[model samples]
Target chain A: MAVDKKFVGKTWPTMVYEVGKEKVKEFAKAIKSNNPYYLNDEFASQSKYKTIVAPPTFAVVFGAKLIEPIFMDKELNLNVAMLVHGEQEFEFYTMVKAGDILYSNTRIIGIEHKEKLDVVAIEIMTKNQYNQDVSKGIYTFVVRK
Target chain B: MKAMYEKNSIDAGDTFNAQQKIDKYRAIYYAGASGDFNPIHIDAEFGKMVGLGGAILQGLCTLGFTADAVTTWIGDPGRLKKIKCRFSLPVKIGDTITIEGLVTEVHEDTGTVVIKVINQNGGDVLTNVQAEVVTK
Candidate 1:
């Protein structure tokens, strides 16, 4: 079945994620990034953020939470078996620091139905504890027909 | 925001390069951290069953590596304001990818650098990758 175009404007409930210092370090190491801004607390404390800041791509960690619901959404009835990540775009605004509580909301922004596949794009917007916009991500998935 | 480049140091046509090795267990660690438990990334048999040959690295992990390339060049993670990329090929374990970026445009008024990431393999792995950073 093709992805329903009606779901294009649908949105998921807001989810909250609390950034952890160790988690940031773990993520940095996983990506082979030894940057002190994301790893060494001592170095980060003296840096501008004054605390360990997550690497820029760490936005995916929080963004994934909202994305999971979309994949699991029964109404959408997505064919997970035929889906693959097609592209990703991220815009970082404020630095995401350790211990910052982030609120994420996802909405279906685009749906392109092709003869052989369907491309679904979900836009996720995250804000910090102060309600300052932290990051925005557009996750595009290609679902084969 | 602090400046990543000198007032007159940056201009269009500047370039930088970075490379990363995809370790054997990179996918497992990434799955643990990112909560992406996709079998195609962690389960070798599952991947082969699905025609992937073997377990493949997560696309986001590869993107993370690309992001590292940009941040390392700029010398600050905070200065990296935006990044986008299209996953053109599957990144298998032990594949060494080199990320090269060229400064295509420099906004003098905003003090931002626009960069395009290209694969050294004739654009086989990652394509249409680009990033923007605030020099200020």
Candidate 2:
């Protein structure tokens, strides 16, 4: 099924995600990042940030979760098996830390059809529970027929 | 240079190193775990056909790694408020990605930190990256 171009500007309802310390460490270990700043509070305190900081890419996990419901909608007819991540861009408003409750609102930015493929772009604007914008990410996915 | 601290906390930029390597198997694992089966990431022939020298790592995988970098720095994954990045180049196998970050801004009122990443090869940048995290 072809994706509807009219849905390009649709914004999904906001979803909330909670940050966890263990999960962050697991992700860091999986990626083999041994940066002491992520592991030792003492070392982090010596740096300019003072508090422990998260790695830059950690948003994918939470952001992706927020977008999952949209793709699962039956009306979309998205072929999950034939989907490929084409590109991703993140614009940051602030650094993320553990214990913050994140709220994300996703929107479909663009849709283009190329022969047998449908290219869809989704933009997610995430904020803390306090309602301050923290980051915005644009992700492109290609769905092949 | 005097070391700067943020409210007795470490800044994300100060914890990152200028050198790191992305292993081939790690790329494969990321592809599997993330369900991103791009041919250019798993098939050398397909990669070459598409103009890449060989199988390249998925851009999302690198992004995921960057997320890991942020979570590790904060000491708790739960404190993450947001993260954002951009991909400038294809990361091939054996490419040593030197992740670096610079604190562009720190908001004390909101407790947010902004940073960027660069893939370095012999001191030359391969990719340009940026992200932000809100601390606890």
Candidate 3:
């Protein structure tokens, strides 16, 4: 069944994630990066952020909090078995640093039904403890019908 | 951001490239880090059963690779103002991704970079790749 278009603009509750230094290193290494900004704290301390930072795509880590509930949302009733990531976009306003308290919110921005697949786009907006916009990600998923 | 940009001289027509070999266990590592343990990415048998031929790397991980390439060149992770891409093809474990970037345009504070990411097979794994970086 296609996800109901009525669910467009639907939103979930905010999620809070405390960026961890080790987790950031794990994510950076997973992506095969040894960038001093992410892995070398002494190097990062002298840089603009003044602390170890995460790669911009780290938005997905915190953003995943929003995705899980959406995938399990009874009303959405998405066919998780058939779904795949189709597209992604991220706009970074501030770099995420270790120890930052991130507050993230998610909303359904789009839904389209075709003959054989359904496309859903969700927007996740995140802010740091200072309420500075850290990043905004548009995650698009395609489900084969 | 300004202090970081002071060290690099970015101009239009500048180009750079980077590559990452998607080792067999790369996806598993990514799954642990990103919490995207969808079966098709971790189980080759399940992937084949699903008609994917084999377990595939997460699209976000591929994007992460590209982001790494761009940021490494720009010299500051924080200056990457925006990036967007369409996942045109599945990147399998053991596939090496080659990222090439061209600085097509530049202004006083930001530059527009067009990125092309291809796999070892010469397939366009990521299309419509573009990123914006702040210079000052």
Candidate 4:
């Protein structure tokens, strides 16, 4: 099945994700990162951030949540099993903290079909509940046929 | 925010080292967080059947560790703008992966930095990451 090119510009519904301290620590531990900046508030406060900070890739989990609707759409002809994370990129406008309430909106930026692969790109823009843009990510997935 | 970059800057080919003994508990925790419970990453028997001698860690988990490396080196947590990478190989349980990164490029206008990571044993290029961070 071919993916709909018309869906390239389609935008998914917004998702609200609450950043938590435990989640940050879990992600840090999972990666075996002993960075005090991510684990200890006291150490973090000593730094310029003045608070605990999240790892760069912490956005991957939340980014996925914001774009869940697109992958869940059957009409996209996307097979979850055959999908592989091809590449991901994030652009940060501001720093994110544990207590921040993040609101994210995702849009499909590009789609291309080759003989045996479907390349799809999704862009997620995340902002704090205060409506300040924090980061924007462009994720590309390769769906094997 | 105070500027930390003024005091330290990581150059390309600069190495960062750390270790992890992939224990059973950590494996389970990763499975829960990543929602990736592939048998090879959890069940040793299943891992052997797939040609791996024992359970292996998820690629994302390794990538997460790489992200931690960046945060530690930069001395800031929330300032990471981007982290992008491609998984080139698999990491098995009990294997202590030493994550290392080099500053490949820096965009002065954008304050973006590019960093690349390689597993210590040279087993796999775990992550090829580019980030736009706020530097001093």
Better of 3 and 4 by TM-score: 3
Error of 4 at A44 (Å): 3.6
Cα lDDT of model 2 by residue, A1-145, tens digit: 7788988888878888877766665555556667555555677676565755555566666776766777787776678767766667776666666677889889999999999999999998889878788778888888997
Cα RMSD to the true fold for all candidates: 2.6, 6.9, 2.0, 3.6
Q: Rank the candidates by lDDT, best first.
A: 3, 1, 4, 2
lDDT of 1 by residue, A1-145 (tens): 9998999889888899999999999999989986778888877897878999999999988887888888899999999999999999999999999999999999999999999999999999999999999999999999999
Name the lDDT value of residue B21 in candidate 1.
74
lDDT (Cα, tens digit) per residue for candidate 4, span A97-142: 7788988888889999999998999999889988899888887888
| Candidate 4 per-residue C-alpha lDDT over B38-135 given as tens digits, one digit per residue, 9 for 90 to 100 | 67778988878867688877767776776666676666555455677776666776676666555555556234455555455766555566555544
lDDT value, residue A15 of candidate 2: 86
lDDT of 3 at A92: 97
Q: Indicate which candidate wins on TM-score.
A: 3
Interface RMSD of each: 2.8, 6.2, 2.6, 3.2
DockQ order, best first, reads 3, 1, 4, 2
CA shift of A6, model 3, Å: 0.9
For model 3, how does the per-residue alpha-carbon lDDT over B28-136 read when each residue is reduced to its tens digit? 9999999988899999999999899999999999999999898888777877899999999999988988999998999988889999999998999999999998855
lDDT of 3 by residue, A56-143 (tens): 9999999887899999999899999888788999999988999999999999999999999999999999999999999999999999
Clash pairs detected, candidate 1: none
Q: What would the TM-scores of all predictions be?
A: 0.93, 0.62, 0.95, 0.80
Docking category of candidate 2: incorrect
**Highest lDDT among the candidates is held by which one?**
3
Question: Each prediction's DockQ?
Answer: 0.62, 0.19, 0.66, 0.50
